[model samples]
Target: MTSFAPDSIVLNRKLPLWYQVSQSLRASILGRSPQDPLRLPTEEQLAGHYGVSVLTMRQALKELEDEGLITRHRRRGTFIEPGVQRGAPVRLLGSVDAIVAQQSGMVAKLLEHGSSPVSGELAEYFADVDEVATYHRLRADERTGEPTNHARNYVRPELAERIGLDDLARWPMTKVLRDLVGVRIGRITDTVEARLADPETARLLQVPLLSPILHYTGVTYDEDGQVLDVAVIHYRGDRFSFTVTLDAD
Candidate 1:
């Protein structure tokens, strides 16, 4: 006999009134009462309970079914899918070069080099204090003389002020950061997302604009956990699939 509260429904920002109403009802079923396998009420029951039209309630339930959150049968009615939880290895950490070097050798190319004032996003990421100088941004492609992964990296200006752009074209930037700047590498945070390739990204990766690609954003930190560099890499979806080993425990 749990009571539904007025504030429990969340309206979808992009949808119409009926869709918003449906989203709210779906949220109640999937988010709040997920453990109650047999609690799915009929369309009329939900309409009266949520103060929405029967059609709107049905539309919301349909969306949930489309998302594979619930299933319906002739007489059995809709039921929540059992939750599945999994764990993965926590110790897997390394740079892209280090990981690839273990498998095969690859070359890094320095394509574009420039500097600009740190934006709000970059400032927050770098913990830049005061009016920080422009940061050196480099766009490079890593491969075996062919397009593999398109990468863009940003480095603090002061630390890389004396370094020549030609030096990066000849050597790995990690070496330059360690040997010249005297910054010790700490840890890197890597995030992967699936996205359709834009014109610029497609041109760099030698693929069509509508092609799918995996966007990898990596943030490198120094010994004090201060961000040293941020890299956005685009990898060809057909050629790359990341496999992470997980712990059963």
Candidate 2:
């Protein structure tokens, strides 16, 4: 198990502080490996991370307890539920290598492959190209067949030509880009948000409409800082968790 820094949490002032804090803690718990210890940081330690008062931190933790995500014992500290770590898929963020390693265990189910006009916001990734190759894919745990992520990928035109459905089904997009296209990825940027699933997203992920989901938009940049691809993924809130690591060096 890796060290978890209590002061690493960053809150978004745009949403309720408690809601954001709860989600972060939930991710930490769900992301725990089976071999990892169940005990979590104390309330005071956790509160210090987000710069929140003890009462606010307690409220955030209460949310987890109500969801059966964690258990609290006096003098024993808070601990993740015994079974929670085994129930959901945990994806590590913060590094390309970590993401690739986690993704290798999942199988990609190709939903659709075709060309589509990029959104205005996405055009920047394609060097202002209006249309690009698009792939709709669903990733599931290979053993359990449980869907974890639904993703739409928009590839730069020339790069897209070399990639086909077969490539995506067998390898993660990052792997395909690195091993097949032979492109060196210099940077990866990811933004995550929690939102209610729309009808289309709900259908693809097999979750109820309006259910909470984790939305991620990730961009891959080449060695020269050129954008190579953009991926938009929807992860089932209950089925997925993210572990992000920070280095102090």
Candidate 3:
């Protein structure tokens, strides 16, 4: 019932001005109700609402038109194309259970899986180790083909050599390491931060420029405090949320 009204979209500088207009308008169409009137605001109204030039606004509308999400009539005004699939509900989780519970929900596409150098901060952080087997996976919402998160995990080269990308795609690192490879786990630490979606990241996540996102860095350690593995996740804030409990101190 909540539509992305033009008044609600604030402009930002990270992306082209016209593209921002288009993104906001696209969100508007996706959130609109089926029974709701399909008429889009007039070009003048839109330009005024979004505080952009009519040329910029028109360019934005043209972008939407090219996408086949809407059409314009001689006198009837712009309208949402019938039968457009409503965007899926934003995924609301941050764990393996959500990733594996459904067969076609969240699956990782292995982009690169091989040994990578450990240098700079990571090298210092894992001073006891040098190189690591790295797997860069892009997780997507299969139903919508929208990327939900990107994960890059590192494991000891010895363990990495024994792990297969196919198995990693189907299971979490913890599961692969603990059950398949029989690695002993001790403790895991996760640090979370709020960040803006950079150009590259925004493209992968299909979100507008400067959209808020969550960056999670986690390290798994053995009993001896040697780093067993590390994982970094970039989650689209619009699609995922982290749930945590608090203890009164």
- TM-score leaderboard ranking: 2, 3, 1
Q: Give the per-residue lDDT of model 1 (tens digit) for 103-146.
A: 12223456666666677877778665433323232233222244
TM per candidate: 0.51, 0.62, 0.57
Q: Where is model 3 more than 4 Å wrong at Cα?
A: 1-105
Candidates' lDDT values, in order?
Answer: 0.55, 0.73, 0.69
Clashing pairs in 3: none
lDDT of 2 by residue, 1-249 (tens): 554442144454545677667756664554444567777878998888779999999998897798777899999888877754223443443445434544554668999888888778886677567788888999876557778788888888889777766878756798689767889888789887889999998887789999999898889899899988888899889876665644353
Instruction: Tell me the lDDT of candidate 3.
Output: 0.69
Single out the weakest 10-residue window by summed lDDT for candidate 1.
84-93
Name the better of 2 and 3 by TM-score. Answer: 2
> Distance (Å) between predicted and true CA of 219, model 2?
0.2
Q: List the residue pairs that clash in candidate 2.
A: none
Off by over 4 Å in 1: 1-104, 129-144, 162-164, 170-172, 246-249
